[model samples]
Target: MSSSSEEIRLAAGTAEVGVQPGNGCRLGSLTVDGVELLRQGERYGSFPMVPWCGRTRDGRFRNGGTLHQLPVNSPPHAIHGTARDAAWKTARQSPTEAVFTYDLTDPWPYPGRVTQVVELTEDALTLRMAIETYGDSFPAQAGWHPWFNRHLAGGDGGQDDSGVQLSFTPAWQEQRGDDHLPTGTRVAPTPAPWDDCFGMPGGVDVTLTWPGRLELNVASREEWVVVYDEPADAVCVEPQTGPPNGLNTLPRLVTPLEPLETSTTWTWRRL
Candidate 1:
């Protein structure tokens, strides 16, 4: 709703998204019915989707029986991959398109380089991040952490009514732990204070409908959705390839993502 400055604006129907490139990635701002969907009040910046949100014990990981140390960015843990703090090179750009590339062959803590492109189209916004291994090693896990405000979706902002209502298919419901991690085992009942990831069947649409016909739907290519409902005035309907911290658990849980391999596409559209 603010004056378009340096941000690239994409328009389709009545929906619009503004994109900015920096910090190794592209950040998007979506608006519908004159309300902003993504949380702009918080610091808005492009962040990488690697090294995960947390680190292994002691910031060390045993890769092929060798120990590697990653710099601790989040006090006791490494946060949000290496690109969150790394500068991304803008390879291509226009009024509505941008491509950012990051080479981490030796400078990065890991042994891979990534090229992420953020494209803004009329109907939706797409971010495609590709990680290619420089050597034989592979990446552990990767994902995007974009914040959204429910108030923009039509929440009344009343004391009791100003919350988000997430609509999922019958088979998607599952429980999670306190750290917002899934327990693998399924629960028959959906618990209160729910903060977990559900299996999002591909092509299944999940909608966040607000009061005034303002809604956002994510059609997943993967099979899961990470629902993060904080005590704040927003909800994060993240489309992830696996659950949070799935890389650091017993039996290894989800398979460790390999190089030249990509997670599924997470696409969002305003309705």
Candidate 2:
């Protein structure tokens, strides 16, 4: 039952992944065949978004007849979810797989348990999450935010690819408003450096290619993916159940009978 002090490392085939249950059950590293594919460092890496994903507009949301206020961490809105900010307990672990769990508490206005499973294969990494409620039904969302390296080792191709080029065909892009939240308008796909959300009704399928190096494919059953490539060193492809401010706009429920769940997988090939 050791927590934070222990960092779980999973290795398989040509890939190695580091999981930090101490720091929000996030994937701290991803290295494939001596090539680092994730942005290194503490602030980066891949983290889970549970109970709710993306922003909560002004840090406020109404559940049933009651309204709850959450701390504004993203300035002007409550971004991500509480799970990413809290440490998780190691529920189980193996060589190439691990399970972590945490309970939902105050400020979230719900009673639930969040469980995340990380499975790494020789050529792929799969992540799954579920939120089971202990009390009244409440709105919730699930997702994963991975900050991929804009430039992998020897993947230098200048500005175009950061050595990494993004390729995806989303059904439509969720038009982002000045507030950085989806305006509920679906428009055609736009260009890069996007802080925008896109819809993929047939599921999310995005690829990042590093010329002559590697190609990573991010796929999920979820319909929404947020592409944020504004940072100079990294690009984020987030797969979630809903868009930002979805707590008020989308509001998927987690009940005693049905839990909220979602998963995303990243498969790669050396080219």
The TM-score leader among the candidates is 2
162, model 2: CA deviation in Å? 5.1
User: Which tens-of-lDDT digit does each residue in 94-177 have in candidate 1?
Assistant: 655566666664335556666666655555666666666655554365556666665654346443355556677736565565
Taking all chains together, each candidate's TM-score versus the true structure is: 0.73, 0.95
- Over 4 Å off in model 2, which ranges? 1-5, 155-162
Query: Mind giving the per-residue lDDT tens digits that candidate 2 earns over 153-260?
Result: 663534444467899999999988899999899999988879999999999999998887789999999999999989988899999999989889999988899999
Estimate every model's Cα lDDT from 0 to 1.
0.54, 0.88
Off-target runs (Cα >4 Å) in candidate 1 are 1-14, 24-28, 42-48, 53-58, 72-76, 105-108, 153-163, 170-189, 201-205, 249-271
**CA displacement after TM-score superposition, residue 123 of candidate 1 (Å):** 2.4
lDDT, candidate 2, at 107 = 69
As a whole number from 0 to 100, the lDDT of residue 234 in candidate 1 is 66
Query: Against the true structure, whose lDDT is highest?
Result: 2
